[model samples]
Target: MPEYGPLHGETVIFTGTLKSLEVFDLVRQYGGVPVSIPLIQVNEVEEPTDEKRMKTCSDFDWLIFTSQNAVKAFQSKMERFAISVNEIPCKIAAVGTRTAAALEKIGFTVEFIPTVFSADVFVKQFKPTDGELNVLFLKGSLAGSIIREELPFQVVEWTVYETGAKRDSINSLVDLLKSRRDCSVLFASPSAVRVFSEDAVPSVGWSGYTIGAIGHVTERALLEAGATVDVKPEIYTLKELVETLSNRKDEFR
Candidate 1:
């Protein structure tokens, strides 16, 4: 399977909030050198109230989860407010496989997962609500505006979690990852890319390195931060990222 699963012996650096142990295992399974340094710290937002949740649970036409962090933060807020998943009286939609899995684990059957993992594609693919579709987004602090801008549905956003750079972890990660022209640093979000680009610039420049982004948003973030992205999957899912790396003939080039 070397021709197909060719990530063996490759050093991959990961930086994100979820502590992607599953991704690490997947990398190892594909024979990659899995190095994960979580640089984005996730903190729950304390502002959501029972009144707001009560309105949200019963009012929205569709409740959309964009990330696993969103699902997790929503669960924590719901539990604190004594809200139940079954009480969310709307159709549920998740963006990625992991996001769908997280919701499923918490007893919510995901009603829709778009054919392509892009928010733009999801906006086009998902069947709208009967009348006006009001989407409640469980999102992080520095999330991109693709969903709000691109979707035809009315979006109500709740910042369920805050994402910030874990500089101590990033500094230490930079020490280990410097001068890795042959290595690929995989970024999953704009925040992670923001952190890495700011912190890792002192020791190494990304001009000669191979950078892998999870999606267009992340790719734009990396480019805006002056990092050259070399690889991204056909689909934006984490599993597909590894597969894309495995399948690419010259991933490190």
Candidate 2:
């Protein structure tokens, strides 16, 4: 008989807005079942100002992206405006490896990524050349104002996407919690945590299932909602989160 790992026979649930095949395969590789029930929905915002702002991409000294959604939305806007990636003269900075990978996929070389995948760390660590620099931050509607408020340089923000709770997934999530006690729920974003707490927690409560959070931000959200976090990776990526969960599977049992 083949020896089974700690994650053997575990049912892992993903509650992020976006589903990744890579993340799913990681769970399966560790002998766990991966379920996708998104708790949030992210959509690009369409406005007349999109083209105007995108046209000014070259005017900025640096372009910043904190989320993969921002990168995806930026690419979409660029395509819509018939603007090639080579046309943008500004160097790009991403907060996390996944965000940087997304930018790199679109042919933008990532110039900076913080040691820690957070805005506060990025602002504290990022050192620019001695000059008046203009940074344009492409972000979602729900993104925090840390970059704009904390950075000393002139920072302009462009809202690329809007995130909202996926109310349709509420019932499914509640049912999962009610029926399964041995499952592990993975939360990638605070928005997903908020939705899970607001819509599903009241029905099934926030206990019994193993909880995994991707980063400190999501872990903080889970804590604020009175949920216990059992798994959190040192690195804030989905792959790392799954690996951490797999390594700590014995603890949950």
All-Cα superposition RMSD per candidate: 3.0, 1.6
TM-score, cand. 2 vs. native = 0.96
Error of 1 at 220 (Å): 2.0
Report residue 141 deviation for candidate 2 (angstroms).
Answer: 0.7
lDDT of all predictions = 0.77, 0.88
Candidate number with greatest lDDT: 2
The C-alpha TM-scores of every prediction are: 0.87, 0.96
Stretches of candidate 2 above 4 Å error?
1-3, 251-253
Best by TM-score: 2
Q: Which tens-of-lDDT digit does each residue in 86-136 have in candidate 1?
A: 788788999888899999998898999987776777777877648777888
Q: Write the per-residue lDDT of candidate 2 for residues 1-253, one digit (tens) a residue.
A: 1147677877899998553599888777777888899988999999988898888899999999999999989999999999998889798899999999999998999999999898878999888885889999999999999999999999999899999988898888788778775689999999999998888888877778889999998899899989999989998898999999988885656
